[model samples]
Target: MMRQWGLAFSFLISAFSGLASVPPDAAAQDRPAVSQCQAIARTLPDVVYASFSASDVLPAQARAEAVRITYLGHSTFNIETAGGVSIVTDYNGWYRPAATPTVATMNKAHSTHYTLNPEPGIAHVLHGWGDGGGPARHGLVVGDAYVRNVTTDIRSGGGVMEPDGNSIFIFEIAGLCIGHLGHLHHELDEGHYAEIGRLDVLMVPVDGGLTMGAESMSRVVTRLRSSLILPMHRRGPPITAFLSMFDDSFDRSYATGPSVTVSLRSLPRKPLIHILQGV
Candidate 1:
């Protein structure tokens, strides 16, 4: 009880002191001029995404204009930018792709989403949890991407809850704000939406019961209203249930291969649900 109050007090102080770090010019324009509340009030929603053909995988010539997202099974995705930076989401010890990543973001929902020991050669390993300290804080630039996180609580066990146990990692690359909801456990609050700002593409968990219920997850996805939605962290039954909630208005398709590259220009006018195989 005391710890919870202390954490609340800390948040209040941080809010009052204006302890926000300086964001990029794009972020500054979209986000509120304060910490915690990063999203700005917007009147219109814009669609932002791009894609490449299956044969275009890892072209020798670096395409600095588009972002490539390769599904490496489960909740892990290899996000490659035009400048040769690579990032792996929900990284565990298993399921490493051919190329090592420049950065790895992890969450503590389960062993499948995180690893105690990561590769030595990896440059950055961002943990979702605060290592029992506080919420994990990450705001760094690597090559062509800017990475940050917004923390949320998780169900520990026996109905107990642990605050700041998970993080929603946002990758700003190629003029797109790509968000990965790592082991999400609840519906987002107003503060979370504000901090998340506007997401162009979103990777969400649809396990129905593990991370959150399909209905609730669907509501959260609709609330974000990103251009593209990539489903992960579940098998067929849950994925099917999650998909049933969205009607024909959403563009639904499965990737031909294990990867799909997207940029701002290739985004659909309406929302899309992309199911990548091998997961």
Candidate 2:
């Protein structure tokens, strides 16, 4: 489905190219300090460096001042909250996509949902509980940002007993609490729902084909009652279905901007549903 096999060789070329023409091991001192968070300018203001290497985990970035959200197509997202918490969700984005991340979230339940190679410099890498039920439970705090993992129910093909590690992330940053649902295969039960309380921004998968259908996603957004809803993973019918739903529920407006960067100081004003035109 995605040309990931080529990315490794390409990564080596890109990594070493940035390092000088030598064996990468020789340039160990020039590895970009992947263990720490270094703020780099992207189209968004405060994106940190992280890698989604598929086998390794990143350290963590502390002391972030702003949060910027960039849609890397499909379900992949790079989020930097004003408090300096950087998060990447279901990182199966493009190979050489313009932006890398500081922290990446990978869910192994579906092939299209997760990718190999996070951005070149991100630190922490988190995964949801997968079908095999491995390495899904994780918790980390970066500066004032607190990130925790919560596993929810999965019923593939509209709630079948697939036992996937669908993840719900809680980000406490900038006096705002936002959550991203990574390839969710089913609706959240009571206990699962209870853990994801008071979400200020909700990143959801509108595409019903890979994850849950539109009705289930609608129920999820309603259940969370988030202040802002950012739609992802819905490149096909899910986008149409999600927009139709949003148009009916809230004053849906297409955003002239790429992302809706919000801080707590600007929140508690009524909820606004923004859809990006160029995502």
Q: Rate the local accuracy (lDDT) of all candidates.
A: 0.75, 0.58
Per-residue lDDT tens digits for candidate 2, residues 1-279, read 134435433453453245335433443333331111111111112222112121121112211234677666666666776545567777665522354555677776666667665555767777676534463665565544556667765555654565545777767554456678877777776556545545667788887656777888887777666667788776567355776654444545677876666654444344556666554
Q: Evaluate model 2: give its TM-score.
A: 0.67
Native-to-model Cα distance after best TM-score fit, residue 93 in candidate 1, in Å: 1.8
Backbone clashes for every candidate come to 5, 21
Candidate 1 residue-wise lDDT at 132 = 57
For model 1, residues 31-150, the per-residue Cα lDDT tens digits are 533322132222111322132121222122322368989888889999998888899999996978798889999998789999989998889999999975878888866665778998
Whole-model lDDT, candidate 2? 0.58
Q: What is the lDDT, from 0 to 100, of the residue 27 in candidate 1? A: 46
The alpha-carbon deviation from the true structure for residue 50 of candidate 2, after best TM-score superposition, in angstroms, is 34
TM-score, every prediction: 0.78, 0.67
By TM-score, who's the top model here? Answer: 1
